[model samples]
Target: MDGKRFQNYEAYFTILDTGEKPITQEWLVSLIENHENNLQYAPDVWREYIKK
Candidate 1:
């Protein structure tokens, strides 16, 4: 993954585990939108993963 995208995932994981703060849906959407071109899987894949 690109550095920016990796950082975004890391931030999300960190927040998820630590309860430092909630990761906003808008921020997650923005991160995916920003890295859409670089993603190996489509956004639907991520949505499915999140649903699980």
Candidate 2:
């Protein structure tokens, strides 16, 4: 992973614990590519992410 995506992964993992569904690398890539900025403050919108 590049620096930005790696940062995102770290930020995401820092904020949320793993749920019933795993947060796999593929999903994180989709999220980073599609909605990178949206998740900077993920605590407010983590549920929306899980659905995607």
Candidate 3:
């Protein structure tokens, strides 16, 4: 992932492991929306991760 653009997003993973915050359905939806919005700038980057 692009570090500068997605630094806080790394917290998504930690939320589950650390239980510091809950990952809500709305947050997941926002994450997908953010990625979709970024597709114009980085389709290849999106495809690379989506394929995995």
Find the candidate with the highest TM-score and give its number.
2
Q: Weakest 10 consecutive residues, lDDT, candidate 3?
A: 10-19
At residue 32, candidate 2 shows an lDDT of: 68
lDDT of 2 by residue, 1-52 (tens): 4545533343334356555655556546657685755454344346665677
**Order of quality (TM-score):** 2, 1, 3
Q: What is the Cα-based lDDT of residue 45 in candidate 3?
A: 38
TM-score of each: 0.27, 0.30, 0.27
* lDDT measured at residue 28 in model 3 versus the true structure, 0 to 100: 54
Q: Name model 3 segments beyond 4 Å from true.
A: 1-16, 35-52
lDDT of 3 at 22: 45
User: lDDT score, residue 20, model 3?
Assistant: 46
Q: Which clashing pairs does model 3 show?
A: none
Clashes of 3: 0
Q: Residues 1-52, candidate 3, lDDT per residue (tens digit)?
A: 6556643443333112323444455545656787555444443433456567
Among residues 3 or more apart in sequence or in different chains, the pairs in candidate 1 whose N, CA or C atoms overlap within 3 Å are none
What is candidate 1's lDDT per residue for 16-49, written digit by digit as tens?
Answer: 3323444456656667676654333334445546
Worst 10 residues of 1 by lDDT: 10-19
Task: For model 2, state the Cα shift of residue 21 in Å.
Answer: 3.4
